[model samples]
Target chain A: MLKDITIGQYFPGNSVIHRMDPRMKIVLSIAYIVMLFMAKGFSGLAVGVVFLAICYGVSHIPVSLILKSLKPVVPIILFTAVLNMFFVEGDPLFQWAFITITKQGLSTAALMSVRIVCLIAGTSLLTYTTSPIVLTDGIERLLSPLKKLHLPVHELAMMMTIALRFIPTLIEETDKIMSAQKARGADLESGGLVQRAKALVPILIPLFISAFRRADDLALAMECRCYRGGEGRTRMKQLKLTSRDIVGAIIVALTIVAIILLNIFFPLAIA
Target chain B: MAAITVEHLSHVYSQGTPFEKTAVDDVSLTIEEGEFVGVIGHTGSGKSTLIQHFNGLLKPTSGRILVEDRDMWADPKKIREFRFKVGLVFQYPEYQLFEETVAKDIAFGPSNMGLSPEEVQMRVQQAAQFVGLRADKLEKSPFELSGGQKRRVAIAGVMAMNPKVLILDEPTAGLDPRGRDKVLGEIKQYHKTQGNTVLLVSHSMEDIARYADRVLVMNKGKVAMFDTTENVFARSEELAAMGLAVPQVSRICRGLAARGLNIDPNCYTIEQAKQQLLALRAGKGADQNA
Candidate 1:
């Protein structure tokens, strides 16, 4: 059941989005988020929606997967929409006893919901396309300039890469440990909150011990290979920005310009 | 009555996802009560997945598993009871030991069954004795013990439950030869004393030939054969085709037979092979005298 997590999940493909330089993808994703917030009304948000749709189309990721990524954020979207709907005061569109659905409130709620959905969809697309190792490499390269301030950028990136690499291994271990405990009649499903938490003691202790053991072994293995703090290190796959990355940056710039124009020229009627 | 029954069992990992793959296909088998069955298979042949169904640790994607003639997942909520009926000791179970004391680790199983403290203590002592763990060492922390000792403790933890059926998946993996023999001997003795059904999954054909009453051969998620140990070992070529082999003694006997000697190719155990060679020599001597 733990395998259902779509966070940090990478769907591998040979599409243009997947092949784009990871550094370019990360920068464009941040730029897209900024554009979404800059959007003033439905017309401005429509630009983001169109750009996102086109990106997904080229990436070849299935619609079901995109929907799966949005599933966990449904409650957050609803909460934001409801807070905007009833709490904001303006010209009342509909009135009951104490609650007033104002004209401005409805427009703001719709706009916020559209913006939040587009934000999630756009960002998840980046993770879906870029592999985790490449993503970390991209981040480290982008942060390389901070070395002038004596920051341990490479060490931090190495730590993140190692942590990401061990997630699936640790998850497999957890499943094995849980099954081993259950075979001995460990009741993890039914109980009060305290009882359930107490039952996890059997699982947690073993998991922690195994994880530490793995880390120790990994460190030893790295040392045996003459690893020394990422200094003077060489990479197997060098990151290079091809024409695909350049074209993607241009498309993103155009989308941002379109959002700016729409924000100025076309505002929602109610707003 | 059969101790465990699997009907058309199939398990698919990550179903409906792009990573979907069937780990176990449409397989059916029944293990009789008080029978010691050795399951032989290559890695990824679904040996582990198939046994996990016996105790409802994994629900089959399209089949039913019955323990002691009752459908394991019929109630779903009461499935824990089946775990107590069929105990599973996973591969390298020594890594699962987490208690402060060896005594406490063995008691984990019985205590989880809601047994009284006294009953739990009694069962823990019995299990420890069965696994040859001394009374004095019971108070020591399990983490401080040697690898073989920790493995025994993990086995005792499950044995304390006194399940009607015990399934072990490569329990001797990563152990020394002596350690492997000790653990396997303890399990054989436990089966004899308790008269419970036992399924031992191993890659070592010699070990299975030494202890198993019957052998079950699995290949590519299907039961290729299930028969008496002698019968399974006799078909060495067929077994070799499945990436398995008979005991080394049996292979030697087969070679002798191929060389026109009157040796039984089905002789698996060392004792049996010795007896066969002795009989063949005696018969030759008598014929020469005639």
Candidate 2:
């Protein structure tokens, strides 16, 4: 059951997007998120959606995965959409007891839903195409300038790398513990809220104990290997921007510029 | 009656995804009640997956698992009850211990069975005793105990449930030779006194040779062989072809036989080897008199 979580999930591939520099991918993903918010109407949001679709195509990620990434955000999308539909005041389309639907509300809801979907899809693309280690390395390199400010960017990235590395291990451990407890007749399902929370005691305590033990072992092993933080560390796979990354950067930059221009030149029809 | 019956069992992990792979495929086997069966397989050969089905920990994708003639997934709601009937001690089970005191950790299983408090307490004491955990150690926190002791506590926790069928996956893995023998010996004694079906999953051929009445060999998610221990070890060539070996005694006996010694190549245990060599010496003395 714990295997269903899709955190830091990287789909192995040799596509153009997969080959693009991780730093550029992270930067462009942030740019894409910004473009989604910058988009003022359907016209601007449409550009963002089109750019994301093009990315999905280039990355060779299946459409099913794109839909899967959007599953978790469906509640948020519905929430904002429903709130906007009922709360916004514009041309009234329907009325029922104190609830009213407005044409402007409908338009806003549509725009918000599209923006949120595009927002998640765009960022998840980054994770899907880039491995966690490479992604952390990119972030560490990108944030290296902050070392001048006495920031512990290397340590932060190292922690992220370790956390990502152990996610599958911890997940497997949790699965084992759950099965062990289940075999002991622990009823994890079909209980009152209090009973359910109480049942988690067995699973959680063991999970925490095992996780801490693993962390302790990792620290010892790292020390044994002479790992003294990331100071003066040389990477074997250096993040160098290739022509593909340059082209990706240009496309993302052009998309953001286009969204801004679309917002300025073509406002919503209602306005 | 069979303690557990698997019919055409097939399990696919992460089904329908690109990562989907069949871990167990179209396998069927029946384990008679009160039988000590040893399961051997290479890593990722479906040994774990197949046993998980015995206790309803995993539902087969396209098959049925019957525990004492009852379909495990018949109700799905009562599957937890079946767990009490068939206990599974996972690999590195010591990591599953959570209660503050060793006694409480042992009681976790019996208490979960919804037995009376007195019954739970009694079972805890009996289980701890069975696993050779001393009375004084029961009150101490399980975490304070050594690794082997903690593992004993974990096994006792399952034993406290008094499951009719006990399945342990690599119970003695990562233990020293003495610790390994101690744990296996305790389990063998438990099986003897309880007269319950026990499925022992181990990588050690010698352990199986010593304790298991029947050995089930799995290869590439299918049952390779299921027969008496003597018969399984007798076919060392077939076993070696599947990346497995018979016990060291059997190999040594085979070496002796190849060198023209009157040794039984089928002997799989040190006791059997000694008896065979002694009898051979007596025969040699008789031949000299003739």
- Give RMSD (Å) of candidate 1 vs. truth: 2.2
TM-score to native of every candidate shown: 0.95, 0.94
Residue B51's lDDT within candidate 2 is 94
Q: Going through the candidates in order, state the TM-score of chain A alone for each one.
A: 0.97, 0.94
Candidate 2 local lDDT, B1-290, one digit each (tens): 99999999999999988899999999999999999999999899899999999999998999999998999899999898899999999999999999999999999999888899999999999999899999999999999999899889999999999999999999999988999999999999999999999999999999999999999999999999999999999998899999999999999999999999988889899999999999999999999999
What stretches of model 2 exceed 4 Å from their correct place? A90-102, A268-270, B283-290
DockQ-derived CAPRI band for the predicted complex in model 1: medium
Best by DockQ: 2
Worst 10 residues of 1 chain B by lDDT: B258-267
Screening candidate 1 with a backbone cut-off below 3 angstroms (N, C-alpha, C), the clashing residue pairs are none
Per-residue lDDT tens digits of candidate 2, residues A98-160?
A: 999999899988888888888888889999999999999999999999999999999999999
- Give the poorly placed runs of model 1, Cα more than 4 Å off: A267-271, B14-20, B278-290
RMSD of each: 2.2, 2.2
